[model samples]
Target: QEVVKRTPGEAEFHQAVREVIDSLGPVLVKYPEFGEAKIIRRICEPERQLIFRVAWQDDKGEVHINRGLRVQFNSALGPYKGGLRFHPSVYLGIIKFLGFEQIFKNALTGLPMGGAKGGSDFDPKGKSDNEVMRFCQSFMTELWRIIGEHTDVPAGDIGVGGREIGYLFGQYKRLTNKFEAGVITGKGLNYGGAQVRTEATGYGCVYFVNEMLASRKEGFKGKKVVISGSGNVAIYTHEKVTQLGGKVMAMSDSNGVIYDKHGINLDTVKLLKEVQRRRLKDYREYHRSAQYTPNGNIWDIPCDVAFPSATENEITGKDAKKLVKNGCIAVGEGANM
Candidate 1:
């Protein structure tokens, strides 16, 4: 209640805080010092937040402006390390929610990193390559003043991927006059990017689910899986799951969902999404027998394993109920979108 009162109108951020606080009830009781120090209150507030205007020209040479922000939420552990999301839905509350979660998530890793998140409300979809590059240039023009190799490192999230990262990194290099590869990640392999970085999240999700299954004396062999989003995470998850003997029947995007009862072909998916940057509808062009439902719920399909690699809050109560009714035994958040 106090947190919500302090941060009014940020319902999502308040909810995130409440969820963590509720889980920490036992911990607070055990360690009264946390309450004494008012650590929770401090954690709720950001260390620094920079909000700037990102103005760029479109393909028609028409100038437009959008809000850009970066939130450095915590640094008690180490330097801030997180991803920069670019999407039409990004806002301060959403960024704060993600950053606040990142703090504890980083702490759990025992890594040399704290927590931060940055992004813009600009939609990269349907934009020309030149327009995207120009937008990235404008975005980094201001962001470069705050980030560094040993200070804050940013990667990709949601709309920000290899293409976006390359543009941002190129602009950073041009502005800073140095090739600091460590300042950003998700770079192309021609540079210093890790080969597994693209596959890590998808593969990591499968591994986590595998561990859970292993604990119960089960595995991915012959399990029916449905993964949302045909992006890097979903495609790689499909690949890895298929390799592990799981049958992936469905994948989706913001537009719609595609259900292939015969299972997805990884090579075709990769060529369509990764190489051509086409939508999930294009998947049907190759697999004419598969079904594509526009703006449909992927969860409605029956499955044993469900991996959501799409947006936040995509699986609502009704969706969960559908998944439960369909006998879904395991669900993994394979990507943050």
Candidate 2:
């Protein structure tokens, strides 16, 4: 209640807080000292929040401006570490929501890293290489002052990927005049990126789900799967699931969903999304037997397992009902949703 009152209009953040607080009831009862120290209140507040203006010129010599945000939620364990998003949907509320979730996520790993999440409302979908470069440079110009190898290290998220990270890192090096490779993650392997980093999240999600299925004395072999989103997480999830003998029947993007009865071709998906940055609808060009539905709900499809790897709140009550009605035995989340 206090969180909502304090951060009015931030529905995501409020929901995140409520979820966490509700879960902590038993813990609070077990350890009243935590409540006595007001730890819960402190945890609800971010240590620092940075918001700035990112201005750059487009290819047409037109100036475009966007808001950049960084919420350093906590650093009790170690330095601040999180991903930098670049989707137009990014805002303080979503950033805070994600960062708050990160606090628990990092803690679960038992790693010496804190929680933070930063991003801008800039959409990189249609931007040219030069335009993206310029926007990244401008975004980093303000971002670099507060981030460092030992302070806040950011990785890729959503609209921010290898290309955007390269531009941001280049600008950071230019500003600081130091080859601080540890200042960021998800760099190109030639520079300092770790191998398996690109496939880790997606692969890990499938691996975790495989274990969950194992608990029920089942596996991914011959299981029909439907994954939402064709981005990094969904693409690799499909690949790993297929390698484990699961058939991925559907994958989606923001525009629509693609259903392929013969199983989705990961190679074609990579070509369209990773190489060409095209929409999932173009998938029909390669697989003539596949079906494409514009703005369709992937949950409508029948599957043994469903993976929501797209944006937040993508699976609604109706979608959940349909998935349950379609015989979906399991649902794994590969995105923050």
Candidate 3:
């Protein structure tokens, strides 16, 4: 309550803190030393928050400016590590919320990386390749000064992906005159990108769900699954689920969901999305029988497993009810919240 009152206008951040605190009553009771040290209060405050102006030109040569931020929330574990999301909804509140959560998530991973997040309210959708390149270069011009592999490594998230990473890394290399591959994680394969990194998130999610199911003596083989989002995580999740013999019935994007009862054609989807950078509606172009539903109920579609691989808060109470009603037994979140 005090945090919410103090940080007015950061509704998301406030909610995140409240949820975390509510779940930690047992921890505080067991570890009085942590409570006495005011660890929660200290973690609420960020060590450094950088906000700057990012100006870039579209193909029309018109200049536009947006705000960029990097909230280094905590470095208790190690160097600040997180992703850079490019979306119109990004702001201080969202960044703070993500950074705060990353602190605990990193600790759980048993990795040396700490917690931080940076982003801008720059929508990449409908932008031309050249325009996106210009934006990434301009964004990285200022970002390169503060980021290093050993200091803070930023990767892709949301609207940012391989193309954006390539542009950002190229700009960073031009400015620093060094081929430091460690400065970023999601680079092109020819440029020191990690092996299987493209599908790691989705694969990790599938592996996690498999473990959960195995504990109950079940598996994805022959199970029906529906995944939201057509991005890297969602596409790869679909691929892995199909490989595991599960039928992926549908996938979605901001525009809408793509339903294919006969199972999604992963090859066409990958070509359309990853290579062509087209929208979900284009999926029907290749598969004549595939259905494209704009603003339809993705959860209403029946499935044994559901992967919310899209943005945050996409699945509402109504969607949850529909999923439960339709007998969705498992759900894996590929998106970081």
Quote each prediction's TM-score: 0.97, 0.99, 0.97
lDDT of 3 by residue, 1-337 (tens): 7788778999779878988999999999999999899998999998899998999999998999999989888888888998899999999999999889988988899999989999999999889999999999989998988899888889888888999999999999999999999989899889999889889999999989988888879999989999988898998899889888899999988888889878998998899888888888899988989999998768889999999998776688899889989998888898765
Which parts of model 2 have CA positions greater than 4 angstroms off? none
TM-score pick, better of 1 and 2: 2
Question: Which candidate wins on TM-score?
Answer: 2
Worst 10 residues of 3 by lDDT: 310-319
Deviation from native of the Cα of residue 59 in model 3, angstroms: 1.3
Cα deviation of 240, candidate 2, in Å: 0.7
- Winner on lDDT between 1 and 2 is 2
Best by lDDT: 2
lDDT of each candidate versus the true structure: 0.89, 0.94, 0.90
Q: Candidate 3: where is the Cα deviation over 4 Å?
A: none
Candidate 2 residue pairs in clash (backbone atoms < 3 Å): none
lDDT of 2 by residue, 1-337 (tens): 8888899999999888888898999999999999999999999999999999999999989998899999999999998999999998899999999999998998999989999999999999988999999999999999999899899999999988899999999999999999999999999999999999999999999999999999999999989999999989998999999999999999998889999999999999999988998888899999999999999988999999999998788789999888889899898999984
The TM-score that candidate 3 achieves is 0.97
Candidate 1 Cα misplacement greater than 4 A, ranges:
none
lDDT score, candidate 2: 0.94
How many clashes (backbone atoms < 3 Å, residues ≥3 apart in a chain or on different chains) does model 1 have? 1
